[model samples]
Target: MEIFFCKSWFRAKKCPTEMWCEEQAKAAHEDGKPYTVLVGSIEQPYCFLEVTRRAVGVSFLDQLLRESLSYDFQEVEPGILFLTMATYREFEGDTGKVESGTSYIFGRDGAVTLRREFFNPQRLETSASSADVAANYSPKPEFGRYEDLIRVERSS
Candidate 1:
């Protein structure tokens, strides 16, 4: 039952602080990212997020299929593969949208390359905001407590 505020421009699992908006505000400001505070929680929040760098191994997918909230696996063409993940929790304000996130697998120089990367603060207009540290795989909201984070297999 931690406090997440609107002033917080960012949220991540395992965030560095419980009162992120308050404690980190100074650092975020020094880094040149200014944001207004808003009120939120796991059940009702602004948006959902996924980090591309936190890739789940291919072997894990088989088991994940059993618990995935909503998902789609397809071979668009040849060696290229596409995967879409959804929320396992049923909620009205959930951030995981159907097919909103994507990744690719392809052949590269005789080796297979899996290009799955979701977090990229550099690409964001507010790179300073990217400073938030997330302990969870992502900042997306869910019904359970952090310890009850969805099964690692199904989530990745």
Candidate 2:
């Protein structure tokens, strides 16, 4: 699975528009800002899950239907598997929210992570203002945000 972050991140890192920073994206959620985190499926039925991008402030809800090939998972249940490291989003996609969180990476063996998505009601209002507006991009039907994923990999 590939995850999509706000494209404006380039400006935040003082890098060229064509560049990306893994550290920057990993720490992006630590600020507690309200940001859109879109996970794209790399399969036949193409779709985008903005489950973690709700308008609420903190509803603490489950927000993912996951299938990962990055690591070997021992299924504790038919539909549930457990692993040690995974990515979590508790802040905005931008630098607006001050909520603090950290996303861990597995490095070599691959990461098995679960993101706990929370919803904010005030953010759903028509006039609600936030600094974490999602940047626009075209999602690929085959790999979702494949380019971003590659960038993260090469940055290592």
lDDT of 1 at 75: 34
Total backbone clashes of candidate 2, pairs 3 or more residues apart or in separate chains: 15
lDDT of 1: 0.28
Candidate 2 C-alpha lDDT tens digits along 97-129: 424333232222342233333355333211212
Tens-place lDDT digits, model 1, residues 51-138: 1122211111111112124222333344332343322322223333222222322222222222322333212111111211112223
Q: After superposition, how far is residue 83 of candidate 2 from its true place, in Å?
A: 24
Q: How much RMSD separates candidate 2 from the native structure?
A: 17.6
Model 2 worst lDDT run, 10 consecutive residues: 51-60
For all predicted structures, in order, the TM-scores are 0.19, 0.20
Q: Which stretches of candidate 1 lie over 4 Å from their true place?
A: 1-18, 33-39, 48-97, 100-156
